[model samples]
Target chain A: MIEIKDLQKNFGDTKALKGVNLTVPDGELFAYLGPNGAGKSTTIRILTGLTKISKGRARLGGYDIEKEPRAAKRQFGVVHQHVNLDPELTVFENLDIHGQLFGMSKAARRARIKELLDYIELTGRAATLIKQLSGGLKRRVTIARALLHEPGIIFLDEPTVGLDAAIRRRIWALIKKIQLRGTTVFLTTHYIEEAEFLADRVAFLDKGRIIALDTPANLMAMAGAWAIDQFKDSGMQTHYFKDRKQAAAFQTDDSFTLRRVNLEDAFLSLTGKKVQP
Target chain B: MINECLAIYRREMLILKRRLIRQMAGQAVSPLLYLVTFGYAMGDKIRFDGISYLDFLLPGLVAMSSMTRSFAIATDINVARFYWHIFDEFQAAPISNVSYVAGEVLAGMTRALMGIIIILGLGLLFGVHLAYGPMFWLPILLNSFLFASLAVALAMLVKNHADQSLLVNFVITPMAFLGGTFFPIARLPGWLQSILKLLPLTHASKAIRQAALGKPVNLHSLALLAALGAVIFLIALGCVNRARD
Candidate 1:
């Protein structure tokens, strides 16, 4: 549903995206993982037509983002990394305006707004102003607004960045439900567990380049099944082992903790840096 | 594009609806104070162009109100861009740059018209009647368009609320005072008159006052305003395009 070919973006002397290429097939839940300033948002911005691409081509649902921006934009819904809803507008009004922008008829907008409010479990708060809502509720309303137009694809850029763990899981379930409904989902995040738990396939983006791309299980397996983490003068240093027995055999006088290898370990093994900076 | 523009315009109208009472009160209070303080004090004392001072000031007040209210959209734009981040939502949507600019400019114009109506009503309350004709609205709209377009362009360039206020203090406030709004431009020296004549609001005041006093409408002023509006609107479009990049 989304195709990016040799995409490059530059801001003067700094390159935000360096010849990155990616393709997310229909109904796939793909996560673009990276640290701060790692080009995850830049890639999403290019795909959503929010920012211009310096080179190469990006297509959304077969429409070129540069040459056919309107049509391309019509094919996808974008939930930006930052909250962008009109604070003075009611929840329903926010969704209503979005539907209208996409040219939905009055009856259609009403029906969609009702359906989305219900879907996001915010029907009771439909008439409430966005500023009155809590952070998690605001995030849900933003998600609902993005889905109002019923686009074929959705780009969620750090959708649950600052939310608490419980709220984050709720959003994760919502995202999974969206994928189950047959919409192609493209998510970007620095949270390793979010990508592991929600994404079908994950791509590691470091310094504007895709360093690793694979399924969570495959990526973890390549890094090893078990990890021994020991606190050092520098920081927490983790050593990977093929199995529990191997990890058990490797011992040190310093205190250590044994845990399962996660996406973070895979990223650290690939790029030698933590995902959170 | 038209539909998208209307959608944005409708959203602004909705916000305006919620704040209608406060907005009208704010709009009404300023002109009323001007009419009471200036109109009553100078009604019998001063005369210009063979009319009462109160009569001469009505059209100028109307012209000034329209300019100030229309240009007030810069504050709204800045709030949306900075505080609310609502511009990003529009950016990611399927709307065209032209549609966004058209919608905002129209919203500003609507605010200007609303201000004009309030001021006109105040004039009626004070027993100051002027000609209400088609010529009156033409220059009013042209003036609103000119300032609204300029507001959009400047809104894009301002970095924050401080910068926006700086723009008002340095650019809009001076124009409001000196743009033939409160007095006749002919009273100024020749050089200052030439410079003030270059302002769109000056032409707007000239045309509106002429129409109000039963003088023949100055097509030259209307034409000048229309030309300035068109040029500034194109500049606003360019600013919108550049801002997205």
Candidate 2:
């Protein structure tokens, strides 16, 4: 479980996070959705103790991140937004070092590394250097490394950002499997579909503030189940309807098309800005 | 904390093992050139404290190599921080700032020890032998500790690889040449001697050369080095903490 209260972060004259508050309960897969520079990574960094918070308090598994950093850090595994594995080291070596950093015994590290390599389905590539692996494989190895010490929570920041659609789905399945294992998962992403497909609850963050928070179905239903997009001389406009027949009836011109309302439409209807930059 | 430091230190040792041969070859080339061009060229023409020029140059080479090799950790730190982003891995882990700095300093010391062995081997081949005693290692270690601690502090302060290289050019290069590694500081002007004598490497060179030649070691220089190393190490710890923020 993670708890944040009135969190604020500032860099000189600019504020990165402004009086933001959030709580993620145990075993919940919560997605913090935002565009670029939307304070998603900043919140994660503050929670993980990577960056100092300018104001407010954060607790990870009941340990204060500022006052009890070591204990707080021991409670969570962080898969950073960027690839941070040692390139010269082998896959097993990377996991081994991480386990050792957590004070895991040698035998424990050996067993965990073996289990995780198999879990990530990289048993054959355990001996390969990180630089030798493909992008998707590297991402999997990073995730595996994060889980080596068996922390209670996992913070994944844009885990599948640049990966192809197929690889992204594979990661999505892995995330589901991780959540099923009873670990609380906190994920941040700009991809609307990722949040919709994987999260139990979603929070929309923009300009250092949380604008909307709810289940995917609830957020979509608040707008409508169906949508009609109409193109005019000025620009394209979309209208949401509760019924499929009504949405179809709203499409009068050849330029108009009827489709199901998605999380993106919910975000647009709520904030008047696209979820993706 | 000790276990965490060793974990980081062990990773560096493993990487060093893979590149051991190439590193040894690279370490040998520069000292060999200096020995041939400077050592052989002025073999008997120059004498310091009644010892041959080559003999006097041998210990200075050891001191210089130890300082440079230990200082090389800054480059490694910069690479880990900027390119590999490995420092972020450590930051997110449960390790303390002290553990990270201690681990890196030890790795630097190990590299310095390796360089000392290589230079001593080269000295034997060139027929320039000297005393290898406890006093010899004590000052060498203190010197390595000094530079390596400085290296970690500077690495934390630098913004990028280019900034790191600029630091080496401005700080380490001058100390290498003017710190009595290639020539005696006594030969310089009195005012310059006073300034160079303030350098930690100068005291390192003086103490190491004295211990090598069976001369009376200056306790003041050794004390100064120990004091400086301790202070710089604390500064490096502060820098590591600041860098994480």
Candidate 3:
């Protein structure tokens, strides 16, 4: 389980995270969504030991992040937003080093890495260097590296930022498989469909504060069941309705079309801004 | 802590081993050129305390190689920081800052040892042998340690590779030339010699040269090198902590 209370981050005179509070129970896939500069990366950095926490407390698996950093860090794995693997190293070497850093014995690392390779369906590509792999393949290997230590919780920051739709779906399936095995997964992404399709619950953060938090279905329901995008010279405006009949009733021309409301619509309805620039 | 240190060291060694051939060629070229050119230009013409200039030049070359090879770690660190983002992984890992610095420093010392070996081989080809005793090696290790720690400290402070290169040009390059490596510091003017003595490499070169000549080495120089190394090592730990912050 992950818990954070009254978290705040300040950079000189600028405030990045402002008195944020959140908790994620074990075995839950929680998605944190926000636009750029919403403190998503700062929160992950503080939790993962990459940055110092200015204020508040964070705990992982009941271990305090600031007081018991090593213990807390050992309880969770992180896949950063960027592909930080050593490009000069082979896939197996990358995972092997991660296991070593976590203090896994050689025999244990070998066994675990082999199992993860098969689990990620990259058993044959273990010997390939990271630089030689495609972007999607590299993302998969990055995920596999994170799981090598078998931590109870995993934090993934934008794991599939630049992949195609097909590749993104494949990664989503992998994520579901991971969550099914009862690991608490904390994820941050810009893809609304990704959160809608995979997240057990979603939190919307803007300007360093979470504006909304609930299940994707519940959040979308709050924005009504259906939405119509009205195109105009000013801009595209979306109108939400409680049902499809109400949404169709508001459409006057071919430029308007009705569809089910998504998490993005819920975010926009709550914050009056798009989730992506 | 030991396990974490070994993990980081193992990563560096693995990468070094992969490119060992190219790295070996790069390491061998510069010292070989120096040995041939300087040995021919002034081998028999001048003598320091009746020792042939080539013999004097050999130990100096070894000391310089140790310093340069150890300090070269900054470049690798900058590459990992700016391009591969490998340091980010380490920052997020369970490894402590001290362990990270220790691992990289050890790897730097290893590179220095490799270069020392290559220089010794070239010296042998030229029939220039020195007293390879503990007195020689103790100072070499201390020299390597000091420079490697400095490398790690600077590597963590610099923002990018270009900035790293600028530091090298301003810091390491000048020390390599004027730190009693290629010539005797005593030959310089009194004021200039005073300035050169401030460099760690000056003491290292003097100590190594004395040991190579089968003479009693200066304990003050060795002590100074060790003291400087410890101070720089602590600075490295501080820089790493700051970088993590």
Candidate 4:
């Protein structure tokens, strides 16, 4: 339900994004992956109407962000990389305030906060100051804050950074539950496994360009079997393929040698193992 | 617009009220020190436009309290929020930018007004007095809000703690000193006096002291300060919205 056309942003002499474009269908879990400073946050910021796109237009749910910022923004829920809770407030109050800003009534806000609190498993510390909470709890509060309004599209920027494995898995499950409920999620993450597991379709962004865009498995199939075998270097042989029929060959192998193409391999193949911003 | 602003105001009020004693006590130091420095050391020797230094300095001291109080809030609370990324919540929220600016302006005004009140209270202990009545609050509130808005604008633009302190010295100190806070601009030569009249606080002080000394109300001075204040407030809101955008 979102379309971006040639989004470009410039900060003085630095060109952050150059003619970047993409789309996300309704209820699609679209992952935007890029190295740091590759304009991932800039694109998200523009989509939210927080920053001006120097040379392009962006639309959310068919509404132009610049012309219909309020309406566009109303349909968006964002969880920035930073912990977006007021440190002075309690966990429940953070969600409540977030809901209230979108014009929710107190009774509704109260019920919603309680529901979200239970969703994130923070009911016990609902009364504690955000500053007093652990990092995982605060991140959960941020995710809960994003989901409070139940917008059609939820945007997460590096949502799991600094989170422990257990908490990260829990949050990933939370996101999966959200998608199951039919919310479109547009997310960016450095963790290849996250993109592989969560994103329905992934976009590899390099140097402000979409180098590759496909399902995780399809991209992996591009990594030939011989190379895959050589890379795996295992007693258990690795079988790979150029297409889906051949891709299933690994599954049928007696040695159980299998080729699984995730985002990390796709990323390495498209843009060598070198950094790009 | 006002309701969202009220939410921000209420949040700030919660912080201030929870630490009411501590907040009030911290504000007392600056004004009290200024009071003693001007009222005790120079009150006897200085005379300007037919008044002792303490008597002349009182109105200015009251205005300065508001000025510094507002600056102090932005410096301590608002600045820290930006650095810690606590401000990201507000940016991502549904609250209007104007409402956010108004809420923060209200916080600054509250602290500044408190400082002004503390100085006024201490004034009575000096056994020196000006006309004290409810009517006096009009000018006081006007000047306090005016300066507080300016402080909010500065907070949105100023780079760091160093720039913050520099503003207090370079901008506010000069405005207080040259704007007839302690002595009448009429005593200066015509060229200097004309330049002094351009200052917003000059009009702020004139309106304040006119009400304080129970003199006839000066509509011109009140209008000028109010107009300058309104412009700065609008510009400040615009700057904040731009920074956010």
The best candidate by DockQ is: 2
Off by over 4 Å in 3: none
Native contacts kept (model 3): 0.81
lDDT of 2 by residue, B88-125 (tens): 88888898888988899999999999998999999999
Give the least accurate 10-residue stretch of model 3 chain A, judged by summed lDDT.
A243-252
- Candidate 4: list runs displaced more than 4 Å: A224-260, A274-277, B41-53, B76-81, B158-162, B186-189
DockQ (C-alpha based) per candidate is: 0.79, 0.82, 0.80, 0.41
Candidate 4 on A112-220: residue-level lDDT in tens?
8888888888877778988898888788888888888888999999899889899899889988988999999999888888888999998877777777788877765
DockQ of 4: 0.41
Q: Candidate 2, residues A1-277: lDDT per residue as tens digits?
A: 8999999999888899998988999999999998889999999988988789999999999999999999999999989998898888899899899999999999999999999889988987888999899999999999998899998899999999999999999999999999999999999999999999999999999899999899999999988999988988999899999999888777777999899999999989988988897
Fraction of native contacts (fnat) of each candidate: 0.84, 0.84, 0.81, 0.35
Ranking by TM-score: 2, 3, 1, 4
TM-score of each: 0.97, 0.98, 0.98, 0.88
User: TM-score for model 2?
Assistant: 0.98
Which model is ahead, 2 or 3, in terms of DockQ? 2
Chain B TM for prediction 1:
0.98
- The lDDT of each candidate is 0.91, 0.92, 0.92, 0.75
Tens digit per residue, CA lDDT, model 3, B116-139: 999999899989978999999999
- Stronger candidate by TM-score (1 vs 3): 3
